[model samples]
Target chain A: MKRAAAILGIGTDHVYEVDPDESGRVSAEKMEEKILYCQELGFSVFFVGITAGTTVYGAFDPIEDIAIICRKYKIWLHVDGAWGGSALLSPKTKHLLQGIDKADSFTWNPHKLMSIHLQCSAILIRHTNILMQANQMCAGYLFQPDKHYETSLDTGDKTIQCGRHIDILKLWLGWKARGHQGYAEHIETLLEKANFFYEIISKREPCFRMVIKPPFINVCFWYVPPSLQNIDQTSLEYNERLDKIAPRIKERMMTNGTMMVGYQRLDHHPNFFRAIISNPATTKDDIIAMIDEIHELGHDL
Target chain B: MKRAAAILGIGTDHVYEVDPDESGRVSAEKMEEKILYCQELGFSVFFVGITAGTTVYGAFDPIEDIAIICRKYKIWLHVDGAWGGSALLSPKTKHLLQGIDKADSFTWNPHKLMSIHLQCSAILIRHTNILMQANQMCAGYLFQPDKHYETSLDTGDKTIQCGRHIDILKLWLGWKARGHQGYAEHIETLLEKANFFYEIISKREPCFRMVIKPPFINVCFWYVPPSLQNIDQTSLEYNERLDKIAPRIKERMMTNGTMMVGYQRLDHHPNFFRAIISNPATTKDDIIAMIDEIHELGHDL
Candidate 1:
């Protein structure tokens, strides 16, 4: 969130972003009209955040209409849910985190879609000592408020980190070997392989197109290159030959070691292919061999 | 550093602090007389930092006389050197970080003295693209300015982190299985077991005392028990009975699971025992069995 409002010093002219609706979510009525136009320019609106998933359009923002305008301006809301919070272990996508139990803070990143390995994340909060009153240092050589056991159970002085690594033991051993019904059948099989690759690349037209069909597992697309497939799809030479075909089919899928994805230019979209169905062991023949290896390496890009 | 000046918002009333000297370093003439008295109250002194080691007085700070008053006030020096930058891999404690290569950032953790395991730290800096102009985020779906390799070698757009963890392969396999003269003989055998536990607790003063002789591996002391060794040391009932004998000998060395050391009350030095030798497998008979286990777990507090 602009690096947590630039580490809370909060500057970019007191940061007030808002805009996101054509399905890349967040427009809770333009975030209540930009918090009533930054409280009519007097400005005190402290917190809102809201993005339930959204890194390259795994979009989920409404959050019960931004928690009813952050509980009518008592502000603080937060959410984030890092990568759709593994759709809250999917009771069929947990109502896309409805109001996230009226979030006072959420964050959740069980390392994106609960695969868990790389730096699993958390945050959570809700209330209790407010993260020990916003991170208590208490550092008299490591939190010794005369420690004979319960020095408030030394959470290392409620951390801004003075040595922290056990990062929740592989997210508590991947939630104890995937319990909650094996993480809701691995988040309903990665949302059914992102709705089966957005229903076969929106029924394969002009060699694949759909950029907005992905509501969660970030499918985004754009293979297109039968030599720009009869150009002029709102051409500027058909988006400069579809922005040089996803970095030349991602440099031939990293020099043909196999398929890869992630391309870019987001809003007013140009370079596409995001494909982030967070690996619940991928197969449907690896999403049809990533669309037949991006149409056999961009079909003569 | 007051949490990087409260994450750069910089306000504990624009943080002043200077003091340290009674052997707990940092008084380059009271830090250039508090940066010429905060520039005669017009205060524009950006950075100074300096430490070199100092987490509980393993003090070093005179970094070549604070790098000549941060180059005569063109400020920005920084040094920290988390635990004496492992005394620069010990060429006899590399002149306690001399001018630390005229520092413009240093940090260095090597997991405190190069044992390098839990989150091995780094920082270093000295100029090049200033950590990509203080952290870049050219995030158009992850820095793809037409990426066919060399999208400015995308270091995830110079990191605030969008998925990070390859935490330097166990500090590069413990510096490739201890090269560099086997990490200077494991940092000169943990500075010779902290000068052999500060020469047997300063030759066992009236049952041990030496709190300030340590300049590096942080020995610090006090154990004085035998029912407070005929008191009257500098009475306030002898520093409140030597501050309740190092937290009752650190709560009987954590209920007798052998020894640990970190006690606190620094400035007026009350609860003493800091110890911190950063384990080079301790043994000088585990520093004389940690002074016969802190005089047998503090002989009658």
Candidate 2:
């Protein structure tokens, strides 16, 4: 989202930020504070982006509260539900994205959690003709106003691309094959598996530490080796050692051809593993095997 | 390219143009004049875009001549070969892109002339690491500096997209299946077919009019219906009548479910058909059939 803003010539200086809370979720109060600050400096805050699922901790920002603020200011509320939009398919998980329908626009990626093919994403706008107004090149060769058929149905003028790939066909086929019920079941199963992992890691105590209670399918945790088990949590030595553990264990995992899990340092926290349960094919045994492999690789470090 | 510039906040005010000559090729003198004019107004003329194969005319800009001016002005020279870059494959047509190697960067889409699957495109840079420097986010989770292997080869940081679809695999497979020699032959054959179409249209005088001598595999021409056959070319009535012919013929073509050809007005010319011979499956019989179909559907109009 920041990259997209940068491409549109909005430099870092122009981008105001509201830091995430301890749970890694953007708070409504913080967002309103930032908006007020920017406005005080004579900035017209036209767009307010609220992420449904953040990248690191699977955090879902309070969209309902933020939407109220956005409505008060008459700002365009855009929800980037790229990672968490699929949760809306399941009745049990739909509450996480509570105020998404109230958004002026929403970005959803079927590729992330829906397990559709890569690059399958959509931006749905509430108003009609706005996209065409913003992106139309009016290339006479392509979109002729005097065509026999209705030119309004010709959506090519609604985006920057003159020639787009048939990405929709695959998404449609996938959706048809897996009906709404099938998709709901898929989401429920992934969430169950993620919850199971979180519970297992929580019980493991000093050996493993849950960074925060995961709100989505991402289970982020730190595998504390025996050497640093007794180290004081506040000491510089503990975090310094904890930071190096994830990379070392990751290297071993890759070298051994066991499993692939991403690790990274998040605000104030050292390097930790972020296990995503998006794949439906992952078995219970596979999850156990992943836990066992991490233990075997990092226990003595 | 203009869309990309617009995305980067380079509006029409910043975008200066050096108009193409009669054949639709960008002359070096005109480019130098435009650059000097922009510089005189205290505007930094930093980039000069030279098209290897323009979309409408299939005209290759004089790259060798333009490169000298770009070098003199210390400007970045980018060649948009989205339409015509495949000419470099054939020895017969390679001379058309003589000074492409001197360009700072070149965009080539294999999906165009190469007949590869859609969305297979690449931007070739003259220097290495520049792309990484410009686009890297240094996201600690993805691009770790202290990885066991050479992290420099990790190309995810070299673009705005954190997760890009593997567009290179299909392109690589297509290249492998069709060797360099086979590709050259494919390009040469397409160019030959385009030339044949051009020849046939040129001979069909009163019924047809060649827009310009095509430089590459895009044969642009006009279907002069019986009503406009005797009309004076300079009159407003002739151009107005001419302009409506293509849309009418195009509507008929779509309704009849025959060949698909794009039509557009360029510069002072009225609507003309741009028949591109890019697909290897297009045969000589098909070319003849297209011309016959256009006449059968349009000549009376």
Candidate 3:
């Protein structure tokens, strides 16, 4: 609905990029080329999805590219960092999102990685109240003078939600509990864990490949059975048939109470499993247990 | 943000009501007229806010006025029963929410009175998948063919939110701990306490009004100054100014640690105090104490 609204709201719009993976990661060259492609296409607005890294037109560029591209093309750059964005607090991952301050408007989900509960998302526009200007209800009931929220910065009045859930308290409490440095340490720890998983899994036989490498959390791995091995016929049927297998395995694994792995057909690959590690409770032992469970259950099938 | 989304995405809205004075009651006739006025204004959607009171518009209607008007106009009806919706389980109060079943959607907040943690708000739609139809973001990585959430329901995908917080456990636990009739009993007890206050306060002051009268958990009262004789312009300003005066008293009350009374402006009068009796710790003694405190402090002013 929001997407359709955006499209309809603007007479003609072009998307610079959208991450198909939803993995909260994008590639460097994908970013650079997308900017260049938009410039070539003579598109004035470049809406970039920077929530998570799932793009690989290959290589990752710092956010400075946004300034560079906009300055070059005289285009408006909008960053949709809707998720995995609260990592901005971490000293370790803050470097990962360098030069984001240059973007015209950026959305960061405090609700996601910041652990502030759902709807705790914040969209900081370098230009203030841009969304308010874009979307207006013009109802006097919303702005009628009041004593409680006397300043009229009800926040709800300026937001997309009517009677928004007060997710701020959760953020406020969480921030109070874990100071800025504490939150940074938390993200740093998660990054270290993500890197650990990438190191352990990427080199394994039949592990296939990861989407966009070590630093990213969602490590995508494909399993090539010995029977289907070495035959590189990329038939549509071969792709569709292999797609049917992973869910069956996932279904049985969940029911059997051993382990459950997320599977989907990403691009050309018939079927693949994606292990998204975000839970803080997850340990190295759990990782080893998960891999062993996957192998033991998947090897025979 | 939800409010803005409703107004922008859904189109046109109004917030015609807020909690009334300490009485926690509003006139049923006034409510009916407001709903009718909304009809006159060509509102296609009726989002009823039925947290407290004998909300009889949609639920009951000897004339079936709201429904008849809605059916005539093909209006979409929704009820926001968030704060006090659990009253649906109470035999005494369920009549207040008569035609709720006819609503397209209903929002119930368990966190309000059920001791459930925050963020446990549920939007129950008559037709399922409307939320998903409204907010699904398709991607290559997360949502795809042969995925765990495909052809089968995984409750999580139906939300605009991702990495959804686990709000069900607290509710499920409440249901288990306080079985079927137990919750209803809780509501009944609370209502009984409300009635107790209403009965005593009415007996205490002959000139005192219940706003919407008895059988309501909330009691709106006015202390007719020894000088007042009529509900004229002076009385309105008197009420409004008096409402502001409570806060000055409240700050001292907070420091004194004796009791607390919330004051706010209402449509019928200027502004007045509103007391929410949901606090189980409250008793008839506390009510009397609060009154005494008000009189002691307010008499001079």
Candidate 4:
């Protein structure tokens, strides 16, 4: 999003990031405040983007409140649901994204949660005519008027690209094979696994420290080694040592071909692991094995 | 390229296009005149793009002269060799791109003449460091410093795309299967077929008007019927009648599944067919069959 804005001549200073709460979800009040501040400065609020599911933590932003603000300001609301948009298919969790229809535009990558092949993503706009107006390049040679069929169906002018890979076929076929009900069941199962992992990690006490309650399918926690279990986390030495643990464990995991997990330090927080359960095939045993493997690899450190 | 410049806040009025010569290649003098004019208007001449092989007529721009002008003005010279870059492998035609080594950047599509699968294109830059400097985004989560392997090998930082398809393997394996010598032979064969087709069309006189001697593997000619042979080509009625022939023949070809050819009206020229011989399997018999099929389909018209 920053790169896109930068490309359009928007400086980094103009891009204001509204911070997320303790649960990693952006606050509705904070967003409204930012919008009001921008208006006060006589700036036209053109775009307001809400991350439906953040990459580090699979937390959904409060879409209902964001949509209301967008409507009031007449700003284009874009929902970046690249990671968690598939959850809308699940009847149980669809309420998480209740006001998704109000968004002016939304981006959803089927490859992530749906487990479809990579490079399958859709950017849907509520006003498709606006999209055409922005992208149409009437190249005379390709989009010919003398075609036998309807020329409106020639989608070449509707995209920034002249030639695009046929990635939609794979996504369409995969969706057909696994019906809507199948996807809902898969999403529900993955969330259940995440909750199950969270419970186990909580019971393990000092060995594993839960960063936050499992919001979506992402369970972020720090695998506290025996040496740092008793130390104050806010201490400089403790954080310095904690930062090195995930990288070292990741190195060992790669060498042994064991379980794989991602780790990153957000803001002032120390390095912590982010375990995502997107694959429905991932069993409870697999989650348990990951915890055991991390312990075994980083016990000495 | 215009759209990209527009996005970067450069208006259409700022863009100046120098017309190509009668041979469809941009003349060096015309290019220099445009550059001097832009400079006179107090515009910073940033880029000058030369089409190595024009789509309508496969004409090679005088790269040697253009490169010298670019050097003199300290401007970036980008060669759009998307259609004809593969000719570099052929010993006979490599001289056409004599000063390609001096170009600041060049775009080549392996999908065109190389017969590699679609979506395989490369932009070769003279300065590798500048590319990295322009594209590098220090994303903390992805480009980690503590990686086991050399992190510099991670190409993710050096591209605009976050997730890219693994297209390199196909190009690499295809290049390996057919070595440099094999490509040279293939290119030479295609050029020979193009010349053969040109000779055949030239013999047919008024029935097939040759659209300049093809510089590359594109054989462009008008498949004029017997009725329009005596008419002056410059006449409005003649051009109007001539424009209808290719489309009518194309419709018949599609319905009969005899042969497929592309047609377009370039500049002030009437509608003409552009037959390309990129396929290695194309034989003299196939070329003869196409000519016979066109006559059979459009003889009465």
Question: Across all candidates, what is each one's fraction of true contacts kept?
Answer: 0.79, 0.54, 0.25, 0.37
Which residue pairs overlap in candidate 1's backbone? none
CAPRI level of candidate 4: medium
The full ranking of all candidates by DockQ, starting with the best, is: 2, 4, 1, 3
The lDDT per prediction is 0.81, 0.88, 0.59, 0.85
Across A29-68, the per-residue lDDT of candidate 3 in tens digits comes to 5666767676678765435534333222112335675567
Best by lDDT: 2
Write down the worst ten-residue block by lDDT for model 2 chain A: A135-144
DockQ of 4: 0.53
| Runs with alpha carbons beyond 4 Å of true place in candidate 3 | A1-49, A52-62, A67-83, A86-92, A104-193, A233-245, A279-289, B5-64, B113-115, B137-140, B144-151, B204-210, B223-240, B255-257
Better of 2 and 4 by TM-score: 2
Name the candidate, 1 or 3, with the larger DockQ value.
Answer: 1
Give one digit per residue, the lDDT tens place, for model 1 in B168-279: 7898888899888999888888888888888988788878888788888788888898777897887888898898898888888889778677788888878888787666
Q: Cα miss at A138, model 4 (Å)?
A: 1.7
**Worst lDDT window (10 residues) for model 4 chain A?**
A139-148
Task: Show pairs that collide, candidate 4.
Answer: none
* Candidate 3 positional error at B126, Å: 2.3
lDDT of 2 at B283: 85
lDDT of 2 at A251: 98
lDDT of 4 at A125: 92
